[model samples]
Every structure is written in structure tokens, then in C-alpha cells.
Target: MAQVHLRDVVKNYGPLEVVHSINLDIADNEFVVLVGPSGCGKSTTLRMIAGLEEISGGEIFIGDNVVNDLPPRERNISMVFQNYALYPHMTVRENLGFSLKIAKRPQAEIDKAVDEAAEILSLTPLLDRKPGALSGGQRQRVAMGRAIVRHPDVFLFDEPLSNLDAKLRTQMRVEIKKLHQKVRSTIVYVTHDQVEAMTLADRIVIMRDGHIEQIGTPLDVFENPVNTFVATFIGSPPMNLLNGVVRDGAVVLEDGTTVPVPPGYQAREGQAVQLGMRADNVMPVGHSLPPTEHMAQIEMDVNLTEPLGTETLLFAELAGAEVQAKMLNPRPVEAGERMTFQVMLDKCHLFDAESGAALRG
Candidate 1:
């Protein structure tokens, strides 16, 4: 295992610079996931760390070795790609041991290494089968096993679960997490799925437009986002944001509904701000949750309700915009009906309307 560090790393293509100067430190044996939307330079950053993309500026260090000019192979890192890049003609055993064979290891050494990798990934039964005969998830395991035989200092996963079906993807996620716990290698995984980042990473690096938006543990980022973008991005169903103005130490929405502003929030009366709340923090009175700081009640017209087994997602109009909230142990309700819900103002977030930044006291 190794610690990876990037200092002012940058990527440029002619006159256009896609990745701005970014710095990050990845500790030894830590699983850090880079997550972002499409075209956010997340994958580019991962490739740069693997030495697959040339840095336009700054230095990259993998275990105290400056690797800015090093090739991917020289970095002693193994990469698992999204497409399961396996050799169709080679059996799983041969595929896993190919790197060792190319490095001139003896047959016994290759066999031992291949066996170990297969055992780690539960691919022992499929060792004799070729990639053409394996399922997508099995083939992906073969790809990871190939990387394992090399005993790399770091592992880079470029959306390795993207090719599998939803069920297989969930299953593979557990397997990957188990593999990490067992091997304990430093890993950098890149994916667009926030759920993947939440469930897999020790810490998540959220990137946007070539810049890092936030880096925090899943719960940390979800509970206290730095801005509207982050507040809306890290959680499922996103956060509900309502435009309002500060008045008499509280926020007044467009429709004259008021929710208390948390004490010590730096805001002046008549300031334009946005009130943010997560779905879990808001609930109908009957489906009660304890209040945080202050709880304010409001009635809105229900537009939709989606029953998600354990909870039902309710969509209603608030401050002229549709906001979503969750109802746990929910009872059925008809659309277009009026209903009352409580907003937990203490758990709320406030953002400067013009800058979109969280208002700090």
C-alpha cells in the first residue's frame, strides 16, 4: 500500500484547459472515491494519478516517488476498467497470470499467484472458462483478479461496476468492499453514482466543472453541504430548496409561509436566501419525527406520491416550487389533495441566493 499525492495537478488540451490545478492527498490503504457528473474531469483526474494522462503542470507522488513523468506501468498500480477488458481467448487462469508470465515468472509462481487471486475474488470455479463464456459480473471479477496477481501498490477503478445489471451491480459492490477489506490496498475509484461513493468510499471527492466541490465522508457531505450544488448533489432525491427572504429572524417564503432561521445564522432582514432541507428531515405530522431546533407546519397541495416499500416519497408545492419529502410507515394519499407537513428548521441549511454559498455566521 502507498500514499498518493497530487500537487497543483493540471491537464490542458491545446488552448482549452479541461482540468484546473487541483491538489489531493490519498492516505495509505484508504479507499477514496472520486464522484461527479459527466464532463466534470473526475475520470481525467483518476487517469492522471495512474499516470495514464500527462499532467500539464505540477507533481504527482506515489509513495514518495514523483510520478509526473512516469508511465502507467512504472507507477506499480493496477487499473480495473469499466468494460471488463479481458482476453476473449484466454481462460480465467491464464488471464489472471498473464502479467506474471509476461514478467518472466516461473509456471509455479504464476499458478500460485493466479490461484490466490481467484480465491480472493471467488473465481476459482471459473478458472478454466474463457471470458466469452462468463457472465458480465464474472468477467469483471476476472479483470480484477488479473490486477490482483500483480500485487500492485495501488488500485484504480474506473467505473468498474457500470457494465453490470442493477442486481449484479449491488452484489459486486459488496464483493468489492469485501475485497478491499481483505487486501487493504490503497484504492482510488471513480464513478458518477453518489450511492456508490456513499456505500464504498471512506471519503468522497465530489468534482464539478474541473474543480472539487467537496471532500468529506458520505454522512458529513450529506448533512452539511457547502453550497446549493453540493446540498442537492450528495443525497438521494436531492434536497428541497425554497426561495425566501429573511424577516424578523425568520425566513418568509413567497407564499407567506414562514420557517424559523437557525439562531446565529448571518443574515439581515430582507436578504434574499434559499432555505434547504433534506427529505428525511421533513415529514407529515402523523408520521412524526422529533424536531431539531424549530419545527414549522405548512399545508401544500400534493402533486405525487411514490411508494418505495419502507417509505413513500411525497411531492408537494412549497414556495411556488415542487419539493419532495419522505413519509415513513406511510399511509396512502391521493394526488392533488391538501396535506400538512412539518419542516425541521434546525436541520435546515441556508444559502446566499446570489452566490449559492452557504451562509456562515
Candidate 2:
């Protein structure tokens, strides 16, 4: 029953506003992530929810109560930070039970909570070991175990995996996902990594420049980005964009390469636009996916090739801009090799050149 609601929330430092008035509704037990580039007010917003930062304007509600004035400790929430923040001298068990110990909980209660958390995080064998004795991933597990021992109604994670190595980050991502499934607590996580947002969040709140850009499920935002920023930001390698103009039922690229406009888009004649396509949607004919109803064929010379195990990522120039295309079924094409590629028109996008907004029908 720990649903969180932010009503026109705003955070200001002196005269400069860092977080603009924003509203959000987080249902109980939902795992929501606040994600964007550095200084986008994501962490600030999470801190406000955690009662770490005082809101300059508007109200915050946790469950049925207004918690705008409550301190973080009094809000029944636990936060796992980027730094492990474990007591160096304390054993894993001691660290896990420290918060409860400070609260003067009964010894039996402390033992039970600590044991449960250790069991959940598979830290039972490390209970006697200090933080210095644990590996990076193990230390992170201990951190999570400490948070779990509190049995808080909500969990706030502020870039908890940023300090870990790439491999450990991936491992911890799985652990965190499993933790969410087991705990079933309302979680508000903040990170600048879109991959983390895509993998961990039940819904992602994409922010930019102190304002929320979009809020939706990961796939919802990926396949249907509302603007150029999101189209380029949410996915790896980003969607390719090329300057173009709509002319006679086709989009004419900068170098006079004409491609049929994508399906289901309302493009004005003679309007400046940017044609968008993802590497997955553009592929060499023999190495392409099943042919779709609406497709455009184009020829380009491969400038570079990244041979991923299953598919190769072919880099080529289109309309004077570099565009990435995927090559399936394996290929050993040298640089400067000419190849005909099929563009999945239904999967492509068009954005207003001036505003970068999607052109939907």
C-alpha cells in the first residue's frame, strides 16, 4: 500500500530552479526508474521523494499520508547508494542489522531480520566477513541486504550500479531484478544509463533539463519515441537520422537519393524533415529479415563493419550522414564494398527538421 504521488513538485536552489513543477504517480510495489543525462534532475527528484532534498513547491504523498515534511528516516524508506557505504569495521551481519540495532529492536528481532535478508541475497556464508573481505559484487549484495533488513515500504536506489565494472553491473542488474520480484516493495531508482532503465524499470521516466520528457514502458518509448532526443537517446548506437525533404511521395536526401516515405506518417509536400531508421530496420538484401510489405531499396558502400557474433553491424554513408545497417546470416565484406540494403519503411520514422518532433499520421 506504499504508493507514491508527486504533485507539481519543484526543487530550487536560491533563484535557480533545478527541478521544475512535475507530477508523477507510482503505484504500490511498482519498480519505476527516473533516468536521463547528468544534471537532468532525476537524482534530485528521487532525493525529494526520499526526503533527502526539501521540495521548494508542491506536495508529496506516500501511501495515504502527505510526506512532504517528513524526514527520510520517518518515511519508512531505505536507500541504496552508488557507494556501498558499509561500515568497514563491521561484519556483514552487523552491517545488515545496524539500522535495527540503532532503533533498539529486540535482539531476537534483529537476528531474524538479518538472517532473512542474508538468505535472500545469498550472503549467509559471508555474514562473518567485513566489507573489505568482499568482492565488488558481494559488497553490493551486502548493501542490498542491509537495505532489506529494514523491511521498508519503499526502496530508493541512486545509481547503485554505476561504480561496478561492466560485467559486475550486468550481474547486479539480474540480482536487483530478482530482489524486486521477491520484496515487492515500491522502488524509485535513478540512473543515467538507459540500458539500466530499459532492463530494470517496470516503467521509465525520461527527463531532460529538469523537465520530464516521456514516461512509458521501455518498449513503448523505444519503438515509438516522441521526439528526436528520445529516438537517439534510448537505444544503443541510436537511430540514424538524415536530413531530407518530402517531394512527390518520397523523401529526397541531401545528395538527391530518393526514398519512399515511411508508412502511416503524414508528411507535407516540400517540407523539411529528417528520415530516421534503426540499424535493425536496414539490412543487406540476402542478410535481411523476412521482407515486409513496405520496403525501400538503396545502394551504399560499406565504410566499416563490426562483426558481432550473430550479425554484423555495417556502417555506411547515406545522404552525407553515417547510418548503421545490420547484416544477418554472416558476411565478410571489406570496407568500400558496395551493397544493396532494404529499408523497412514501416519501422522507419520521420521527424520535423526544425523541431525534431515525430511526424505521425
Each model's lDDT: 0.90, 0.93
Residue pairs in collision within model 2: none
Q: State in Å the error of residue 314, model 1.
A: 0.8
TM for every model, in the order presented, reads 0.97, 0.97
Error of 1 at 179 (Å): 0.5
Give lDDT tens digits, candidate 1, residues 45-95.
Answer: 999988888999988899989999888878999999999889888999999
Per residue, candidate 2 scores C-alpha lDDT tens digits across 1-361 of: 7999999999999999999999999999999999999999999999999899999999999999899999988999998888988999999999999999999999999999999999999999999999999998898999899888998989999999999999999999999999999999999999999999999999999999999888899999998888898899899879999999999989999999999989878799999999999999999999998998999999998999999989999999887899999999976999999999999999999999999999998
- Where is model 1 more than 4 Å wrong at Cα? none
